[model samples]
Target: MQTPPPKSNCKSILTCLLVFLFFQVFTGTLDAQEWAKKMFATLEHDFGTVAKDSMQEFRFEFTNLYKEELHISAVRASCGCTIPTAEQDIVKTFEKGTILATYNTKAFAGARGATVTVTFDKPYFAEVQLQVNGFIRTDLAFSPASLAFGEFSLTDKPRMEFNVSHAGNTDWMITDVRSKNAYYEVEIIERTQLVNQVGYKMAVQLKGNIPVGYLQDDLIIVTNDVANQEIKLPVSGKVSAPVTLSPSSLLLGITSPETEINKRLILRADEPFTIESLTCDYPGVTFRTGSEAKKIHIVPVTFNAGLSPQKIQATITAKVNLNGEIILKCPLSATVE
Candidate 1:
């Protein structure tokens, strides 16, 4: 009986050992993928504490360890609080890429933990999340922190300028100026003492290359005034060319949220004119002309703020069939007034 040692018990032991070996082999196969051996900077970084309204950037470095060329398809951050910038969304061949996590310390205050996700073409990593942690100061403010010079034509080189004045202390200074995008140009005209005001005059200029739609971006003002934190200046405007229409902006006085209103603008010449096309900046708005005749042709523009905000702003772009090849655009600014 001792020699028997329970044949069933022996079979159970052998089965358990086989199952363990199978799992080891499966796991090893998965671990051999390109991303399994990838290396990253620390799993997380602490930027420490910064001013309430400041600008800061945290960059994470990573590399590929596979023998084959590693391809990175995209890099994404967890929140708008952190803006991720990289040389290329798609990393080619065997190379290195950086995820620049720019935290708008102004928008996010107190202790925060954000993540930046990197995606690869390889099936190995559905997504790789990088972490960032920091403390944002809660004692800071900005006046006229945002600027919006509503819609203008492409023919017009419009320049909108705004000021950043601090009240807490004079130790603060605008350390850097950055645009959410690069098509636009922003410069500090003079960081000088103008009329006893110790601040800088920021000149925001746009090239009008933005697609014919709602154009918006944020200009980050990095200031030493408060520990190099950032304050976001929202820059918004419409792009238009010179058109025959008069009084470009449309105003639908204090209408109810569910109310719809319409107005007409004449696009006509002394003799005759043909409207090649009429386009509106906002999809929620549109325009139409009758018969395409030149003599005082009425172009009706409609506004529907139903269940929408009381104020609506946009641009009307007109392409006229003329020999001059003019790019006529006009702003259609409307408010409660």
Candidate 2:
């Protein structure tokens, strides 16, 4: 053996090792900010030219791809022309959230833009900026601003009408109306021309072929104005199933054999509907419903664990009246301990 190192030198070497490890961890945290940026698919949206007093909205959607919970610590907008909001605060892994940027149509007009900053504190601190800009014409406006269809069934063919007026120009005319959505059809039903003013009455109809989900689209109107060629109208509605089910899938966590669980299955429709029958092939699973025809029915289901512990996977089917017979099915899952 030649010699052993001194105690002070050994201590200094150990300190260097600790510092190297800490630097690695700190840099890793800084790199995670890039992960937050990766969640957004796009960073900017241009609303172009829109009619004043009309609804202009855009959603900056982001999904959490990490294992940790993604969170929005704060949300802000650079100007009052664009109002920003978070759909929720904390989003779990693989789930989606939206940063809604809504233009302030009632109060402000003319060209406007905003920067929406979203701050995340969890899964590492990060900041994301989203941009939106639009030219809101004061001379052009919609009487109702937007087409809101609310809720309706697939069999119901609904039509709504609104008027668009342009001031300060007598020669202004709507050349044509256009829509790229197959489920919704839009057209100019009437036109009124006056000295220094022009107007149009437009109608939108929801077709029967639309599936059950939220309906959202923009109807573009081509105008004769050389500077601004198109005006957009936002349309929103929901095409609901005659017999709708809630909770998506039943998630009954681990339980004991002596447990008797009571759960609810909510059924709703756009119109008054009656459930002709409810069936389930799962052993020890039973259900009961009301007999009256109504817009909603609450079906109470009871689950008995029997005498042993096991996993349960089953499906519940319901028959309803929507001009004829319509079937709705839902999945049920549970584990007994």
Candidate 3:
């Protein structure tokens, strides 16, 4: 038989256990911090001098050197001036990921800075803080900051003009305009060159015969200022079809074999026109439209599923009389079982 320990001795033992647990928790937190430091390539970024209203981004790359998978649960910036994003959260052993931090130059002007904190919850709990610093000069300004072309016909050429001014140096000249898009034509004219101010008139033209879809592009204005050489202007608009189709793609969902699926489509135009003909490439797909010409017309389309399970894909072409023969296409698809 063994003698039992005294109550005081038991209490001492329990206290020692608690202290050891505390030590483990504290050391774990320290180890996590150390791991984060070793994983990141760099912890700080200085953007030097950046142009106002220009979009800028920095990538903080890291690799999971440990054998275990590393998960980044959350990435957040201290202020709205900076937005942080992770390319991927889970990184396997020896894999890499990037933390993208974008600075909002439009909302934040004249000396902006923020701290981004990245938190990891898996493999081990850890947190890494990154610092970014930059200065935005107030000397350059744009009247509209951005360009919007609104809605335009594909056959019609559209043009827009805006002004850029510099209050710092009078000799600040726009040396060149650069755009990768072949459809855009840009022209810059010096509006005024005073003792303490300089101004330029910028004209952007969208050529006719551009592809029918949305237009989102940027024009880079290269200037004589060495510190801030390139300035970006955003251009956005939609190039609309003269003859538009609502629900451009007809979806019949899922249907049983030999069943019929009926759907309605709306065809519209800015001006009144007549739909000369409508046809579908698929064997069992058909459409019917009214004979009268109008700005808007509704057509009822039907799809007949054969006696088998199959996937359907077809193009519906509409010939319309608007100035000339305008051909509009709508895609049709369905699954039959």
Candidate 4:
């Protein structure tokens, strides 16, 4: 401060600052690429030429090379045509995980490309994008591609309708519809037949006795196309329970030892019911219900972090009075720091 810096000296100082900033940005980008290269064996997959109505899948395997634990927060695809799934989100040092990419050739035809982005939060924040490309021939066509029954009750039978059409052969027909699940029944009706086209209406029914939870299966449509005969249609829906728990998975994040954490959960049902008991396998967890009993309920859960840092996996079971005692299990997870 005694002698203010000259103009040239100030300019040199400013140039040094700019160089430092640029070096930091460049190093960051290089670090991210190095991390990804050490983790993934391959970052792209091409399906070349895939047959229409055929299922194609690829797995991008990665290993955690860092000493700290790695957790994948989310895996998203650029298009709805490609479905990406993470086998396990939390990976320990030297452990392995997989990113599964499923391409729906029936729903999307021609040249298609999608990029799957995997975001990591634990240890540090980072993102890696994987690319997938494929070409689907247009021999067979399904109107809806898959059967979605939406949200239906366990006591109600749901029905869905879709169409299947073929381009070249008018004699093409669906020989039979088969499913391994006994809860599903199918009926096919011939709608039209032309010189170069053939079409049919398919009616799929779900029985009323199906259990409550998410439903995901495939219906094999055996066809007369000798070259490509078997066509699979994915079936998905949720069979909601009479009593439902909102926010089924409660994550308490990171907490200090001996700290008390409380969270509120909402229970909804189609009719009035009373909670008989609420319990958890972990000794440090407890819950309490409101005094009033109706179609909606508020349950407050308390968790006491133990004396040491550890990971917790406790299933909170709730017994409700319906036709009989109905037990619902909600998974709860937390990390103590």
Candidate 5:
């Protein structure tokens, strides 16, 4: 089964930004006083020039790279233009958390910047500061804030329309709209322009065949502005399939031979479904399933290690009868020594 790409291996502007920050963040981590910075994926984000009331946001995700547990005491923003919140207060080894920064475009306009300071109190006492900078143009605005695709199914072709209004500049116009993902089409229609005001109607349509997963993407709006030419407009949605397994990737801790462990998982779908049978990709693994047909099913899995010491990597496939027949697989791993 296809999984979402990790923070390090992103497809968008992350590739370009990581190259420049990777060296700086790593080099700074070598310093004894700045060691905490190493855990973060990135230390900065530029929201670029956005329209008024755009409600832009960026997630500064971090992973615990050390052997000790990581704890976040507080997350604070330096300016009212941005608000920072901690997604998870405590993170285990190899686990992740985020310092979510939201840009307040409604109250603030032009030259918006903030310093997000994350305080750590457990396993270490340190603070990491992240930079967030963006320009909120008062001249430009969006009616609906974003292109909210909402939730749909695998067989849905959803579309949304938004309007862009610009005050003071009659020549202001959106030259082009661009998106990295090829699953959508954007149509720009020019609205009636006044002597000193401009407007545009943006219609976005998603194809029916988009892969099943959470779609968190953005569209780059190219404009004629000489200083700032690109505007970041976010698009978000989720596509549900016939069947899905929550926590598709399970992590089991260290284990030894003859040790058996039981874990529970959530199997879900839009419609009522029943698990016809369960199968495991590896030996010494079994599953306990129920017969009740429902929209959500609880599945218990058991894994017994072999006599030898090794790593356990397995996938559990469940034959589910929903609309007809659907296969759902969940990958799990553990370390046996």
Candidate 6:
């Protein structure tokens, strides 16, 4: 290699160093400014005292005061029981927006306090938390009232368990367990622990006959915990019934430079049930279930595959046998190519 160049001049080196330092300082100031601007509002109201069975909501509003377009990173509630709804668009800059939060007073009776935090983009990108308070009925409340088991594969049995905390601090009893649908069932094993806290081990099982589409049902747990009537907990999800595809999976048998092909999958459930919901994890995937079969009793699941990847998996949920007391579940599977 050639010899290294001669050393630089002291003045030139100093000038280069100053230039770099200037850029660093300028950028730092710009960043600091971006974090300083904001205009916000919230439902920040109090309901004071309320009954046990009634449900209510609290909404908040916010806006961008920056000269440039503003963006909101996220808006989250302190707890899931307090549902959060925010602006639909993310890249909204210097525009007006709103965030809505609905607190389910279901299991929250008596005096209660909760908060929601919102984050935005600017120089001073910071999180602002808002609070809402009210009295909730402590007669009977399901801690972690809502159960959302996201997306699961056909063979996967997703599960979660929560506690029942009383505000009145009174000891109550769960009398009976039942479901509106038959395909799925739940079991409650009574046990006492955690110092004065009492409840049961509730398990919901879906049968293999579950169709591919949407599945939903409610578990009506009759409890002396409440006055007279039984409280209900909803269990819901989308199901991907059984499916079959030829030469499964994408990019498997491709030999030509630009090969074009088409395929389909037949999806159907073994028993009758209504598809409560249908969801997909992948963008290239699609599904079709019941419109005609409103109240599915024993409907055939048909998955029509079209240029979809082979060897894909999905799960569907539904409510079956809308009567009597029983514990059961519906599970299904499908193949792609």
Q: What is the TM-score of each candidate against the true structure?
A: 0.36, 0.66, 0.46, 0.54, 0.67, 0.34
lDDT of 5 by residue, 50-116 (tens): 8888868788988665557888899998999999999999998656688889999999988989999
lDDT values for all models: 0.61, 0.82, 0.80, 0.79, 0.80, 0.50
Ordered list by TM-score, greatest first? 5, 2, 4, 3, 1, 6
Residue pairs in clash, model 5: none
lDDT-sorted candidate list, best first: 2, 5, 3, 4, 1, 6
Q: What residue pairs are clashing in model 4?
A: none
Model 5: number of backbone collisions: 0
| lDDT digits (tens) for residues 145-212 of candidate 4 | 56778888766788888887778878888898877787887888556987798888888889865656
Give the lDDT of residue 92 in candidate 3: 71
User: Candidate 1 has what TM-score?
Assistant: 0.36
How many clashes show up in model 3? 0
Q: What would the per-residue lDDT of candidate 2 be over residues 72-170, giving only the tens digit for each residue?
A: 999999999999999879987656689989999878888899999999999778888899998889999897888888898777879999999999788
What global local distance difference test value does model 1 have?
Answer: 0.61
Model 6 ranges with Cα > 4 A deviation: 1-103, 106-136, 139-144, 167-171, 193-197, 225-228, 244-337
- Please provide, for model 3 over 167-252, each residue's C-alpha lDDT reduced to its tens digit, 9 standing for 90 to 100: 87777888887766777888875478887999888788887645556666667778888877877666677887788887866756
Greater lDDT among 3 and 5 belongs to 5
Candidate with top lDDT is: 2
Query: Model 1: per-residue lDDT, tens digit, 1-337?
Result: 3676699999999999999999998776666433433546455665555545644665576644333455567777777777777655554332345677777776677778778777666634545677887776664433344466687755565777765554445455777777657746777776554343466666777774554344556666677754446655556666554446665445444556656677887765555657877787666677776545464667777776657554555567776654444445666544332
Q: Once superposed on the true structure, which residue ranges of model 3 sit more than 4 Å away at CA?
A: 1-78, 82-103, 110-137, 250-337
